[model samples]
Target: MPIHSKLPDVGTSIFAVMSGLARETGAINLSQGFPNFDCPKPLKDLVYKHMIAGDNQYAPMPGVPALRQSLAQKYRRLHGCDIDPDTEITITAGATQALFTAITALVDRGQEVIIFEPAYDSYVPSIRLCGATPIPYKMQPPEYKVDWERVESMITPKTKMIIINTPHNPSGQVLLEEDLLALQGIALRHDLIFMFDEVYEHLIFDGIPHFSALRYPELYRKSVVVYSFGKTYHNTGWKMGYTIAPEELTREIRKVHQFNVFSVNTPIQHALADYVNNEEWYSALPGFYQEKRDLFVDILRQTRFEPVDCKGTYFQLASYRTISEEDDLSFAKRITREYGVACIPVSAFYVDKSDFKVVRFCFAKTPDVLEAAGERLIKI
Candidate 1:
């Protein structure tokens, strides 16, 4: 018998593969970009309290009112943008759902969805599942900078959207204002939808400011910005995220979202709203994570592997060219088996790995975990 598959090319995610290997080998589980530490006690307590106070029912199709209002205020505070909480904000299960909904809502069969290579794994699958074509533009290794000319050239009449992630995963590269300007030009010229994934918006380090898609008022009408409480609140399991877009676009995305997850966890959403609205909590995040990033980098400085400068995200890219000539996947497996340290290979994110020799280390663990992993990595 033969079986059909919608995503025949897809398999278990690289994150899952590396994480399972880490578990079996007893390697420090640094392969996945989730926090090993617990979320804020205050946030968790609030959720429990809300549940105790009888707020466990399903929320509004879009999102809980309080949460949406708080999220709108957050956008205003952080990005100096005003979004209508009722019409322009829709919360989903997580940023993943938000991305899927946005893609499904906007993309049509054979339409091109341009994504930067070494991208988050979901982009390609989500685009393909929506019957859209994924046009990957590779970001060069060592310094994963965008090739604007190449990107501009990829924009054709069939191009329906461009997906961008700031504080980019695996590479930790942040999109600059210049990059945004170039993207704005391309989007305006081609009339393409701009989907920005900013789950790591608050995780930027080294005094680099996050560039929001909403910053460009010219492209605001065409942009859908997705953000998550999971990354910011250190609660990946919570899986609560929201998208900000123009009323018209959000309505369509919400249609997909309404049936997808229908609503996020109710009390949790309220708790996150409270947490984000607290100025002190959100304000201190940069310094809080920056210290962890620095400590991890400092520990790896003694290693043979050259750790790339991470401007943002808890993940760091390290070149293994000096350590071994082995390709990224093999090197990653070897490190897990021998060094007892788990990490993700950057090449897995690319369509082709002809010239890439890098792996990604997630530093979202405790200091001791980072130190232990760092010590083992140095010997490799």
Candidate 2:
């Protein structure tokens, strides 16, 4: 029997495709956004300690209390906003799940979700599965700046939510305070749910302060903020993340979350709770990633690819327009097979898979790995 497909167009993700091809061809993979290096040794040891101490059982549905409390303290200290760990935060498998859970809870059939173009791949599929319409507002390259006027004009009575990511993936554009203010205005006027993806919160660069929606009282009340422990702690495989919202919004998300992923990993939750308490661990991330970004960008300058200004995230976008006029998908695959370096096409992030002659490279690897990748890229 042919099963009906909700996401007929959604096949294997581009990240997986490129990474797979890189593996098959023995190419250096800069396609996926994960570090090639191991996480902090002490952090690993703590997880081992917890496992040995018999914390292998399932965690509480919302999360381990200790972990939630640690997160609450961090948010209070960083954002100056008090969050009730028990009521507001729910740990999930990853930011992806947290995002899907939020959308599942808020959007109904025929409701519209306004997502920016070159948006993350997961957003539209999640929205579609809920029978909601994804209304994309395309942001041009080079800047990918959000025009508040255009965003405001897209609003309608059926608009149920607006999803945004800062230190945006594929493109490394960070959201300014003005962007948040504009979103706040639109959300207030429409009484819409605001879903903020802040997984790359700590990965921002160049002295730019991360403007979290939790910073605004009104936005906080209406927003569901998703964050990744994997992104922060450099253990994407652990798949630990959480969502923060007002008590009421959280209640709805939790209703869906309980069944989706009743609980997160046990030992890791205990381990992360202990590790994150040290301020230096995450506080140093910006500078750490900035060094990697600088190394990668500096090396890429030797190539024909024109690098875009990367504000945050480990990913950097480079236009190959000068080198080839081919569409991004073909260009990405060809480079992986022929040039011995792999990257993601920026078009894969868009719903329509629009081409921009741009490709995204992940620079979260070691300097030597980036150097090797850079040398291969220079040949193209």
Candidate 3:
């Protein structure tokens, strides 16, 4: 008997494919969204310290109280939102888990979820696995701004949720206060649940403030906001993140969270609790990433590829139109095999594989790696 597939069309992630090709070809890999640097030594030490102290058993289904409390203080300091640690927060395996749990917990079969494309690869599949329809609103390149009126137009009785990403992956666009106001209005009118993917909150650049759904009272009540410690601390492999929702919403999310992941990494959560109190790393994140972005963009600007206006996030989109008329996947593969620098074709983010001749390069790498990739890229 043939095994039934939840996602019949889903295959390996494009990020994985490009990164693997880069490894095989001995090319500089900028296709995947991860830093070439290790996280702060102090954080690693903290994890070690806690583990050696023998706090290695299973964590509470909600999370360690200390980490949740630290996170609560963080919201107060950064966004001026007071969140109750005990009832409103739950540590997840990662932002993706937090996202999946929220979708599975709240959304019912046949319920519609509105997602923006080019979106993160996981969104549609997660919605599909839980038997919900993912309605993708295609956003064009350059600006990639959302039209609130258009979003409202897509709403039907079956519409249960609207998910959005800021400092968006593959686009580097951050949502502004106006965008939140529009979303707040629509979600209220339609009674739609909100899922805010703000894992790159601290990674935003050039003095643009991240307007988190947590900052808005009306939005927060009906929202499930996901964050990543990996994104913040340059340790994606840790797979540590959390969700902040209202007490009632969080309660429902934990129902699914308990059985799926149960709890996140224990020692790391302990380390993060102490680490977040300092705030030095997160405080200086914007400038740290800005320098890398400037170096990478400056280098690529000398070539035929045209860089888009990257306001936030470590990813940058450069249109390869001037160099090749080939589709983005072909261009990406050729560049990796021939030009020696790997990148993600933006078309892969879309369900329909909409091609704009644009490809995304990650700038989260160190100066040396960025310089090396830039040197090889300029030859093309």
Candidate 4:
């Protein structure tokens, strides 16, 4: 029997591959975008408390009312966006599901989605699964800024949506207010929908303010904003996230969401209801991660890898060109097997798997783990 696959060419994720390699060879694993440190104990305790109080059942199809209410309050307090939780917020298993559901529900079979390359691995696959074409706009190194002219030029009648991520993955680049305004103008002119990935919203550094899609009224009306509790609390394993959209858009997303996992973990939803609004914890994240980013950058400067300016997220890109002319994947594997340091090849993020002689290193680990990885890396 012959079985065709929707994603036939897709192999195992690079994160899994490099992490596996690190495990097998006892290398320092910095390939995946996850913290080596444990999540805050209070968050864990809150989950336990909810579980003990009998919150183990399925959550509401849209999400727990209390949790949604907390989120509504949060948006109002932080981003000045007033949301009606009942019609606007739906918690998903993670940010990935929210993105998938939105793409599937809104996009037609022949439509196109514009995604910037060296993108998050999930975006292209999600777009392809919808029978939608993904248009790649290649952004270069040192400054992964969006070329709005090139982006607008790519738009056709078939172009239905544009996906944007701030505090971006791998590149660690962020879209500023001016950038968002440009995007807003484009979306309004073209009547395009937006899928805004802001999971690393709090992880921005050097006092850079995160200009969320929520801030743009015209864009927010046609956008689904994605966020992750796991990214905030250093607990990616938990896989908790939510989406925000207008009532009509939310209606379509919930049509897909109701059957897809039905709802997120009830106990976690209950736990988050009590804990999500801790202004102090989220407020202090930028400075906390900035220290780690600075330490990692300083260490890499002494070595062959030249560190790029990392504006946001815990990931840092390094130019390995000074030491080796080898392709990124081969170089990444060589370093993991030989030097005992694991990093993700930046090419894996591109549709062409474009090698720019750069690789991404996760700086989300604790000082001791980072120091240990640094000590080994400097020797090479």
Model 3 TM-score, all chains together? 0.99
Q: Which 10 successive residues of model 2 have the least lDDT summed?
A: 182-191
**Which residue runs does candidate 3 get wrong by more than 4 Å?**
none
The residue-by-residue lDDT of candidate 2 on 1-380, one tens digit each, is: 99998888888988889999999999999999898888899999999999999999989999999999999999999999999999999999999999999999989999999998899889999999999999999987898888888888998999999999997987899998998898888777877888999999999999999999989988888999999988988899889899999999999999999999899899999999998878998899999999999999899899999999999999999999999999999999999999999999999888888898999999999988999998898898
Give TM-scores for every candidate, taking all chains together and pairing residue i with residue i.
0.97, 0.98, 0.99, 0.99
TM-score, candidate number 4: 0.99
lDDT of 3 by residue, 1-380 (tens): 99998788988999889999999999999999999899999999999999999989999889999999999999999999999999999999989999999999999999999999999988998999879999999988788888999999999999999999998987999999999999888867878899999999998888999899988998898999999999999999999999999999999999999999889889998999999878788989999999999998999998889999898889999999889999999999999999899999999998899999999999999899999998899899
Note the residue pairs that clash in candidate 1: none
* Model 4, residue 96: C-alpha shift (Å): 0.9
Instruction: Answer with 1 or 4, whichever has the higher lDDT.
Output: 4
> Cα deviation in Å at residue 340, candidate 3?
0.5
Q: Per-residue lDDT for 265-363 in model 4, tens only?
A: 999898889988999999999999999999999889888898889999999999988889999999999999999999999999999999999999999
**Residue-wise C-alpha lDDT for candidate 1, range 15-69, written one tens digit per residue:** 9999999999998988988998898899889999899999999988998888889
Model 2 error, position 319 (Å): 0.3
For model 1 the TM-score comes to 0.97
State each model's CA lDDT, in order.
0.87, 0.92, 0.93, 0.93
> Model 1 segments beyond 4 Å from truth?
353-355
Q: Could you tell me the lDDT of residue 224 within candidate 4?
A: 93
> Following a full C-alpha superposition, what root-mean-square deviation does model 4 have from the true structure?
0.8
- Candidate 4: clashing pairs of residues: none
